[model samples]
Target: MSADIQKLGEVDRMIHEPARLMVVALLSAVKEADFQYLHRSTGLSKGNLSVHLSKLEEAGYVAIKKTFRGKYPLTICRLTERGREVLENYRKVIRAAL
Candidate 1:
């Protein structure tokens, strides 16, 4: 396997968590999405989604925003530039490995 693939294999375990991976994948697919959107799409409970989102945010892969939409509080998440680079590198590693 290539060096990049080998490197990714090590990092893979970190981002490979089911919920976190889903969050990353979904956010990567879109510019940004709300908390409810992720919760609904992943079929995870609010608490569960919150926990995972916190972890991803701590890891610096995602950024969270708190705002009000028509007087209703909203939490929106977006992937960071670092996250996009990591995901792209991961894809490259996977392609090379395969």
Candidate 2:
């Protein structure tokens, strides 16, 4: 193959995976979303969603916050500035490949 294609192959494996990509894509559109909202949107199980969120958080691609909404604790998710730039670059690379 070519150097260009090889570079494309280097797409961030973490974000390239389908499930995680969906999670990032969904979060990219909104200001922030709660756990339940992501659960319903991604159709991923609670456990699965939690795991993905943790990975993203660790990557510094997302910021997860726990806050109290009255008597209940709410978990909110949002892509960080760096995350947004990465997502956009991913899109560019994929589009360029096509």
Candidate 3:
């Protein structure tokens, strides 16, 4: 249906991408995750994951914090309220379209 197609179009492009979607979905299941954990889970190269995270951070969908863990650099990522809402909306849109 045209209306269903239109709903698909309304899905958030950011979360729609496969890589970003995987990240967001994983984040949704936890309070937060470190860069290494995400890398292992998603199997994304470090550079690719960093780039995707930067995009999400710029969009205010995710928060990234840099800190030291036992003198080691640590990057933590978490989904923001806006990110949760957008992901929820994205799911609805996809469901409706299907």
Best by lDDT: 3
Q: Give model 2's clash tally.
A: 0
lDDT tens digits, residue span 1-98, model 2? 76666669868878998989999999999999999999999999999999999999999999999998999888999999989988998998887776
Lowest summed lDDT window (length 10), candidate 2: 1-10
Task: Report how far residue 25 has shifted in candidate 1, in Å.
Answer: 0.8
Candidate lDDT scores, in order, read: 0.85, 0.92, 0.94
Q: Model 1: per-residue lDDT, tens digit, 23-84?
A: 89999999999998999999999999999899888888999999989988889999999888
| TM-score per model over all chains | 0.85, 0.92, 0.94
Q: List the residue pairs that clash in candidate 1.
A: none
Q: Pick the candidate with the highest TM-score.
A: 3
Off by over 4 Å in 2: 2-4
Predicted candidate 3 versus true structure: per-residue lDDT over 1-98, tens digit per residue: 67977888678899899999999999989999999999999999999999999999999999999998898898999999999999999988888878
Question: Residue 43 of candidate 2: its Cα lDDT?
Answer: 98
lDDT of 3 at 38: 95
Q: Candidate 1: TM-score?
A: 0.85
